[model samples]
Target chain A: MTKKLMKGSEAIGEAAVQAGCHLFFGYPITPQNEIPEYMSMRLPQVGGTFVQAESEVAASNMLYGAAGSGERVMTSSSSPGISLMAEAISYLAGAELPVVIVNIMRGGPGLGGILPSQSDYFQATKGTAHGDFRLLVLAPWSVQEAANLVQDAFDLADYYRNPVLILGDGLIGQMMEPVEFADSREPIKVLPPKTWAATGHNGSKPRSVINSLFLDPEELERHNFHLKEKYDRMERDEVRYEAHGLDTDYDVLIVAYGTVARVCLTALEELAEEGVKVAMVRPVSLFPYPSAAVREAAAGAKAVLVVELSMGQMIEDVRLAVGRSKPIHFLNRVGGMLISPDAVIDKIRAIEDGSSEEVRHA
Target chain B: MLETVFSRPDALRDVTTHYCPGCTHGTIHRLIAEVLDELGVRERTVGVAPVGCAVLAYNYFETDFHEASHGRAPAVATGIKRARPDLVVFAYQGDGDLASIGMAEIVHCANRGEKVTVVFVNNAIYGMTGGQMAPTTMPGQVATTCPLGRDVDMAGHPIRVSEMLSTLRTPAFVARASVHTPLLAVNAKEMLRRAFSYQVAGRCFSLVEILSTCPTNWGIPPAEATTWLEKNMLPYYPLGVFKTPERGSREPLPLEG
Candidate 1:
C-alpha cells in the first residue's frame, strides 16, 4: 500500500475508522481539534455517527453509553478538556467498558498553552481519576506510530474490557507526515463477543446492566480484585520498549518517550559520530512501563540521563527501574517548550564528564 | 382458572425493590413497566438510570439498562439511542439529577432533538442524600442545607424544567404531570405512555416531568404528603402539557382537577 501524506490527527481518525470504529463523540480543544473535525466529515460517508458534544464531560459519557451498547467508540481532547473527562474515564474503567481515548496533550495546571508538552504523563499513567484502576496508556513518538498504535488501542481495549489511552502531544497531532495504514479492512485481532453489553434482552437472555456501583463492601472488593487480575496480566504480557545501542558499550543510558525519545534518537547518532557511545530505551507503553529494559540497560552503562517535555515526570519510573545501581540525571522543558537534539546531546555529555549534578531533582 | 387483573407487568423483574416506604418511585417504575408491556417493546428497550433514589432502577426492569453518573443519564441515553436507533431508550432522573447537576445534559439532549425519552421526577428536595436543597426545592421549604426554610433571597426560585425545556427551538414532547392522587396517578401514567410512544415512533425527543412525594424527606405522613404536594407543589408546578409535536406551540395546556 502506498503511504499517504496526512496530518497526525487526521491519520489517527482514519485509522480508528478503518479499525471498525464508526461512532465518535468529541468536543473541540486546541491541538486535537483536527481529530473531531476529521471525524465530523469522514464518519457520515461511511454510515458512521459523529456527535460534537457540548463539553468533554458530556462527550465522555456518550462514550460510556456507546461502549455499553457494544460499539467501537472513541473520543479525543486536549489537556484541560481531558481533565473534564476524568470523571467519566473513571466510570468507564469501573464499568469495564471498552473505549479508546486520545489526549493530544498541551501544557497546564489549568488552561495552559496549546503548544506541545508531555506534562500530562502523570495524569495519564497514575491519576487519570480518583480510582484504583489504570488505563492502558500508549505513548507514540511519530505520526506513523500514532496511527498504528490507535488501531492497536481498540483491540487492546476490547481484549481486556478496559479503556486504552493514546498519549500524544501537540506536535504529534499537528505535524504533517507520511503514514501507511493497513490496506485490508480487517481488525488486528479477533475479539470475543461482548456478552456483557447492555443491548436489549429480546427475552432470549437475562437483562444486561452496565454499572459501576457496588454498594456492598465485599462485592466492591471482589470487583477491585477482578480488575487487579486484568492489570497484572497486562504487566506481564503488554510491556513494550525499543532499546538502541544496548549491544555495544555505552556510557550513558537515556530514558525518554513520545517526541522526546525521537529527539534522543537524533542525539544518539550525533554522539556516536563524536566517538561517544550512548544507549537509549524508548518506552512504547507508559503504564506497563519497561522497567526491566531500563534496569538491564542501566546495568551496562555508567550513568542514566532521563529527558522529557515536562518537569521530569517519567524520571520517577526510571528511578524505580534502575534503583540505586546508577546515578540518574534529569532534564526537561515544560509549558510547551520542545527539547532540541543538541540539548539532549549536551545533557549526555555532561553526565559523561561528571560535571552534571549526581541527582537532578524532578 | 382464577382471573388475574393486577398481575406484575412482564417488563418488571420478579425481585423486590429497594425504594423507601411511601416513596412514589415504585409507582413511577410500575407505570413505566406497564407502558413497556403495553407497547410490546420490552424486548428491545434500554433504560438509563440516574444517581439518585432510582439508581437501582436497572434491577427492577427486565430490559437492558445503564446506570449513569449523577445528572448524566440523558447523555448516556443519547448514546444508546444513537448507537442503535432501532432500540427504544429512556432516561430516568430525579429533581437534583435533572434540574440541578445534569441541567446541561438534559437541555442539550432535548435541543438536539435526540430520539430518546426522559422521566424527570421532581420531588422538590434531594432524596437519597439526606434531604438537601435541590434546584427544584420550593421557596420556604425546609431542607438539610436550608435548615431555616429555603430563603428565596439566597437560594433563588425553583426551576420549571418542562417550561424551560419547551422554549428550545427543537420540536419535542414536553409535559409536567403529578401522581399525588389515584386520579392524578392515572393521568401521570398516560403522560408516561405518550413519552415512550414518541420514542417508539422515532418521532422526536420527549420528557415527562412528574411531581412526586417524598414522605420521609418532607417529615410528613404518607397520606398528608399527598395533600401537601397538592397544596404546595401543585400551585407552583402546575400539571400541563408544555409542548407537543402536533401543536409545535409554546403555549402550555394546564389540566383541570
Candidate 2:
C-alpha cells in the first residue's frame, strides 16, 4: 500500500478501520479530536457507527458495551478525558472484555495545558483505577509506529480478552508524518473465539453474561488472581524495546519512550559529535516495560539520563531497572514544553564532570 | 398435585432473590421477564444491568446481560444495540442509577433516538446505599441523608423522568407507571411490553419508569409502602403515558456530528 501524509491522530483512526474495528464512541477533547473527526467521516462509509458520546465516561462505557457484544471497538481521549474514563476502563478490565483505547496525553494533574506532555506516565503505567488490574500499554515513538501498534493493539486485546492502551503524547497526535496502512484486503489474524460475548442466543449457542461484580469474597479473590496470571503472562511475552548505539561502550545511557525518545535520538548524534559516547533504550511497551533490556543497555555505563516530557515521572521506573550501580540523572521539559538537543548535551556534560548535584536540583 | 395455573416466565431463572422483604424490585424484574418471554424475543434479547439495587439483575435474567457502571447502562445499551441491530437490548436501572449520575447518559441516549429500551425503577430513594437521597426523591420526603425532609428550596424539585424524557424530540415512547397494586403491576407490565415492542420493531428510543415501593428505606411495612407510593409518590409523579409515537417509527436524530 502506498503511504500518505497524515496527522498522527488521523493515522491512528485509519489503522483502526484496517484492523476491522467498526464501532467508535468518543467525546471531543483537544490534541486528539482529529481521531474522532477522521473516524466520523470514515466509519459511516464502511457501514460502521461513530457515536460522539455525551462525556468521556459515557464513551468508555459504550466501548465496554460494544466490546461485550463481541465487536472490535475503540475510543480516544486526552489526559483529563482519560481520567474520566478510568472507572469504565477498570470495569472493562474487570469484565475481561477486549477493547482498545488511545491516550493522546496533554499536560496535567487537573485541566492541564492542551499541548504535548508525557505527565500521564504514572497514571497509565501505575494505579489507573480502583482495582487490581493492568492495561497492556503500548508506546509509539513515531507516527508510523502509531498506526502499526494500533493494529497490534486490537489483535492483542482480542487475543488476551483484555483492554489495551496506546499511550502517545499530544506531540504524536498533532504531528504530521507519512503513514502507510496495511492493505484492507490483507487478511487479519484469526483470533480465538470470543465464546463469552453477549451477542445473542440462538438455539445453538447458550446464553452469555458479561459481568464484573462478584458478591462472594472468595470468588472475587479467585477472579482477581486469574487476572494477575494474565498480566504476568503479558509481562513475560509482550515486553519490547529498541537499543541505539549500545554496541560501542557508552559513557552515558539515556532512557526514554514516545516522543521524548525521538528527541533523544537526535541528541545522541549531537553528543557523539562532541566526543561523548551516548546510547539509548526506547521502550515500546510501557506496561510489560522492557525492564531487563533497560538494565542490559545501562550495563557498565558511568551515568544514566532519564529524559521525559514530564517532571521526572519515568525516572523511577528507570531507577528500578538499572538499580544503584550508577548515578541516575533526570532531564525534563514540563507543562507543554520540549527539550532541545543542546540542553540534553549540557546535561550529559554536567553529569560527566560530576556536577550532577547542580543539574539534579535544576 | 395443584393445577399449574401460573408458571415462571422462561426468561426468568428459577432462583432465590437477594432483595429485601417487601422491595418491589423483584416485581419489576418479573414484569420485564414476562414481557420478553411473551414477545418471543428471549433468545435475541440482552439486558444491561445497573449499579444500584438491581445490580445483580444479570443473575435473575436467563438471557444475555451486561453490567454497566453506575448510570451508564443506557450508553452501554446503545453500543450493544447499534453494533448488533438484530438483537433486542434493554437497560435496567434504578432511580439513583438512572436519574442521578446516569442522567446525562439517559438523556443523551434518548435524544439520539437509539433503538433500545430502558426499564427504569424509580423508588424515590437510593436503595443500595441504605436510603440516602436520590434525584427522584420527592419534596418533603425523608431519608437517611435528607433527615430534615427534602426541602424544595434547598434540594430543588424532584425530577419527573418520564415528563423530562417526553420533552425530547427523539424518543418514541416514554411512560410512568406504578407496581403498587396487582392491577397497577399489570399496567406497568403493559407499558414495559410496549417499550420492548418498540425495540423489536426497530423503532426509536423507549423508556418505562416504574414507581416502586421501598419499604425498608421508607420506614414502613410493605403494604404501607404500597399505599404511601400511591398517596405520596403518585400525586407527585402521576402514573400515565407521557408520549408514544406512531408504532414502528424511525427518524434521523442529532448525533452531534
Candidate 3:
C-alpha cells in the first residue's frame, strides 16, 4: 500500500474511524481541535458518532459510558482539558474499562499558552487520577508516528482493558506529512467477550454490571492487587524504546521523548562532528519509561543530559534510571516553548568538558 | 398457591433493596422495570446510575446498568446512547446528582437535544450524603447542612429544573410530576412513560422530573412527607408538561430561536 501525506491529528481521526471506533467525544480546544473537527466530518460519513461534548469532564465520562457498553470509544484534548478529564480517566481506569485518550500537550502551570511542549509528561503518566493506576502512554515524535500510534493505542486499550493515552504536541498535531490511508487495513475486531459489558440482560444470565465500587477495604485491596498484577505483566511484555548511536563509545548520552527527542537527535549529530562522543535513548512508551534500557546505556557513559520542554519533569525518571551510575543533568524550557537543538548540544558539551559556561545563541 | 405478587418486569433478585423505609426510589425502580417489560426494550436498554442514594442502583435494575460518579450520569448516558442509538438509554439521577454537581451536564445535554431519556428523581434533600442541602431544597427547609433552616440569603433559592429546562426549545419533552400519593404516583408513572416514549419515537432530550419524598431526611412521617410535598414543594416546583414535540419529529428546534 502506498502512503499519503497526512497531519498527525488527521491521522488519529482517520485511524480511529478505520479501527471501527464508532464514537468520538471531545471538546474544542487549541492544538487538538483538528481531531474533533475531523471526526465531525468523517464520523457522520461512516454512520458513526461524533460529539463536541459540553466540557472535558463530559467528554471523558462519555467515553466511559460508551466503553462500558462494549463499544470502541475515544476522546482528545490538550493539557488543561486533560486535567479536567483526570477524574473521569480515574473512574475508567478503576473500572478497568477499555478506552483511548489523546493528549496534545501545551505549556502550562495554569492555562499555559497553546504551543507544543512535553510539559504534560508527568501528568499523563502519573496524574491521570489519584490512584494506583497508570495510563498506557505513547509518545509519538513524527506526524506519521502519531497516526500509527492511534491504531496501536486502540489495540493496547482492548488488549489490557484499560485506558491508553497518545501523548503528542501541537507541532506534531499541526505538521503535515506523508500518510497512506489506503495502506491501512480494516480494523481487526478482537473485542473481549461481553461478560461484563452493560448491554442489558436480555436472553443471557440476569445482567452484567460495570462499576468501580469496593465498599470493603479488603475487597478494594484485592481489586488494586489484581490491577497491579496486570500492570506488572504489561511492564514485562510491552516496554518499548529506541537507541540511537548508543553502541558507539560515547562520553555523554541524551535522554528524551516525543518532539524533544527529535530535537535531541539533531543536536547529537552536531556534537559528533565536533569530536564529542554523544548518544541518545528515546522512550516511546512514557509510562513504561524504558528504564532498563536507559540504565544499561548509562552504565557506560560519563554523563546523561536530559532535555525537555518542561520544568524538568521527565528528568526525574532519568535520575531514577541512572541512580548514581552517572551524573544526570537537565536542560529545560517551560511555559509552552520548545528547547532548540543548539541548547542541548551546549549543555552536553559543558557537562563533557566542565570548562564551557553555557553556549550562546542556542 | 402464592399468586404472582412480584411484577414480571422485575428481574429475579431476591435481595431486598437498601433504601430507607417509605422512600420512593424503590417505587420508581419498579416503574422503570415495568415499563421496560411492557415495551419489550428490557433486552435492548442501558441504564445509568448516578450518585446520591441510588449509587448502587445497578443491583436493582436488571438491564445493563453502569454506575457513574455524582452528577455525571448525563454524560455517561450520552456516551452509551451515542454508541448504541438502537438501544434504549436513560439516566436515573437525584436532586444532588442532577441539580448540583451535574447541572452543567444536564443543561447542556437538554440544550443540545441528545436523543435520550432522563428520569430525574427530585427529593428536596440530599439523601446519600447525610441530608446536606441540595440545589432543589425548598426555602426554610432544614437538613444536616442547613440545620438553621434553609435561609434564602445564605443558601440560594430552590432550582426548578423542569421549568428551566422547558424554556429551552431543543428538548422535545419536559415534564414534572410527583409520587407523594397514589393518585400522584400514577401521574409520575405516566410522565415517566411519556418521556421514554419520546426516546422511543426518536425525539431528542425527554425528561421527567418526579417529586419524591425523603421522610427520613425530612424528619417527618410518611403521611407528613406526602402532605409537605403536595403543599410546599409542589407549589414551588409546579407539576405539568413543559413541551411535547410531534410523534415523528427528528429536527432539533433551535434553543435560541
Candidate 4:
C-alpha cells in the first residue's frame, strides 16, 4: 500500500474506519476535533453512524451501548474531555465492554491550557474512574505509530473484552507525517464470538445481558478478582517499549513517552555530538507500563532524566523503576506548551553539569 | 374446567423484585414485560435500567438489561440502538435519574431522535435514597430534604419533562400517562406499547412518561399513594401526547421551511 501524508488525529480516525469500526460517538474538544470531523464525513460514506454527542459524558455512555451490541466503536477527546467521561468509562470497564478511547492529552488538573501535555499519565494508566478496573493504555510517539496503534487497539479491545486507550498528545494530533493506510478491503483480525452481545438473539438464543451492577458483595468481589486476573495477563503479555542506546554504556538514560519521547530522541542525537552518551526508554503502553524495560534501561546509568509536559507525573513511574539505584532528574513544560528539543538538551546539560538540584526529591 | 384470567408475562423473571411493597416500579416493570412479550421482541429486547429504585431491574426482566448511571439511560440506549439497529432497545428511568442528573443525556437523545423507547417513571420524589427532594417534586410537597413543604421561591418550580421534551422537533412519540388507577394503568401500558412499536418500526425516539407512586417515600399508604398521585401529580404534569414524529420519514424535519 502506498503511504500518504496525514495528521495524527485524522490518521487515527481513518485507521478506525479501516479496522471496521463504523460507529463513532464523540464530542468536539481542542487538539482532537479533527478525529470526529473526519469520522463524521467518512463513516456515513461507509454506512456508519457518527454522533456528535452533547458532552463527553454522553459520548462515553454511547460507547457502552455500542460495545454491548458487539460492534466495533470508538471515541476520541482531549484531557478534560476524557475526565468528563470518567463515569461512563467506569461502567464500560465494569461491564467488560470493548471500546477504544483516544486521549490526545492536553495540560490539566482542571482545564489547564489546551496546547498539549502528558498530565493525564496517572489518569489514563493508573485510574480515571471508580472501581478496581484497568484500561489497556497505548502511547504512540509519531503519526504513523499513532495510526498503527489505533488499529491494534481495536483488535486488543475485542480480544480482551475491555476498554483500550490510545494515549497521544496535542503535538502528535496537530503534526503532519506520512502514514501507510490499512486497506479497507482487507479482513480485520477475528475476535472470539461475543455471544453475550445484546444483538437481538433472534429469539433463538437466550437473552443477552450487558450489565455491571453486582449487588451481592461476594459477587462484586469475584468480578473484581476476574478483572485483576485479566490485568495481570495484560501486564505480562502486552508491555511495549523502545530501548535506545541501552546496548552500549551510556552515562544518562531519559524516560519519556508520546510526543516528549519523540523530542527526546532528537535531543539524544544532538547530545551525541557533544560526547554526552545518552540513551532513552520510551514507553509504548503507558498502562501495564514498560517497567521491566525501564529497569533494564536504567541499569549502570549514572542518572535517569524523565522528560514530560506535566510538572511531574510519569516521573513517579520512572522513580519506581530506578528506585534509589540511580539519581532521577525531571523537567517539564505545562499548560498546553510544547517543549523544544533545545530545552531538553539544556536539561541534559544541567543534569550532567550537576549545577541544578532540579532532580526531584534530590 | 376453568381457564386462568392472568399469567405472568414470559418477559418477567419468576423471581420476586426488590422494590418496596407500595412502589409502582413492579407494576411498571410488568407493563414493559407484557409489551415485549406481546410484540414477540422479548429475546431481542435490551433494557437500560436506571440508578433509582429500579437499579436491580436486571434481576426482574428475563430479557437483557443494562444498569445505567443516573440519568444516562438515554445515552446508553442510543449507543446500543445505533450499534445494533436490528435489536429492540428501551430505557427504564425514574424522576431523579432522568430529570435531575441525566437531563442532558435525555434532552440530546430526544433532540437527535435516536431509535429507542424510554419508560420514564415520574414519582415526584427520590425513593431509593430515603425520600429526598427530586427535580419533579411539586410545590408544597414535603420530603426528607424538605422538612418544610417545598418552597417554590427557594427550591424552584417543578419541571414538567414531557412538556419540555415535546418542544423538541425530532421525536417520533412523546406521551405522558399514569398508572395511579386501573384505567390509567391500561392507558400507560398502551403508551409504552406505542413507544416500543415506534422503535420497532424504526421511527426514531419515543418516550412515555408515567405518573407513578412512591408510597413508602411519600409517607402514605400504597392505596393512598395512587390517590395522592392523581390529586397532586396529575394537575402539575398533565397527561397527553407531547410530540410524535412523522412515520413517513425518520429524518429530522427540515429546519422549518
* Model number with the top TM-score: 1
Q: B1-257 in candidate 4: lDDT tens per residue?
A: 89997999988989988888778789999999999999999878888989989888888988887778778999999998888888899999999999999999999998898999999999999988999999999998998999897899999999988878877767468888887777778888888888899999998789988888888889989988878887898888888776677533222232110
lDDT of 1 by residue, B168-231 (tens): 8898999989877789888888998888898888889999999999999999999999888988
Off by over 4 Å in 3: A181-191, A356-362, B1-8, B247-257
lDDT (Cα, tens digit) per residue for candidate 3, span B102-182: 999999988888888999999989998888999999999998998988999988899989778877767478878777777
Model 4 Cα lDDT, one tens digit per residue, A187-293:
34567788878776456777777888887899999999999999999999888898888887898899999888888999999988888899999999888888888
Give candidate 4 regions above 4 Å deviation: A184-190, A201-206, A358-362, B1-5, B246-257
Window of ten residues with lowest summed lDDT in model 1 chain B: B248-257
The fraction of reference A/B contacts recovered in model 4 reads 0.76
Say which prediction, candidate 1 or candidate 2, comes out ahead on lDDT. Answer: 1
Please give the CA lDDT of all the candidate structures: 0.92, 0.89, 0.85, 0.87
Candidate 1 structure quality by residue, lDDT tens digits, A1-362:
88999999999999999988999999989999999999999999999999999889999999999999999999999999999999999999999999999999999878889999999989999999987999999999899999999999999999999999999998899889999976785555688989998889886776799999999999999999999999999999899899999999999999999988989999999999998999999999998999999999999999999998888789889999888889988889989888899998888888877789877444
DockQ of all candidate complexes = 0.86, 0.75, 0.77, 0.65
Candidate 2, superposed: residue stretches over 4 Å from native: A184-190, A358-362, B1-4, B247-257
Estimated TM-score per prediction? 0.98, 0.96, 0.94, 0.95
- Between candidates 1 and 2, the one scoring higher on DockQ is 1
Q: In candidate 1, how many Å is residue B26 off?
A: 0.5
Error of 4 at A115 (Å): 0.5
| lDDT (tens digit, per residue) of candidate 2 on A48-143 | 999999999999999999999999999999999999999999999999999999999999879989999998888898978989999999999899
TM-score, structure 4 vs. true: 0.95
Question: What ranges in model 1 sit over 4 Å off?
Answer: A360-362
The TM-score of chain B in candidate 1 is 0.97
Q: Which candidate leads in DockQ?
A: 1
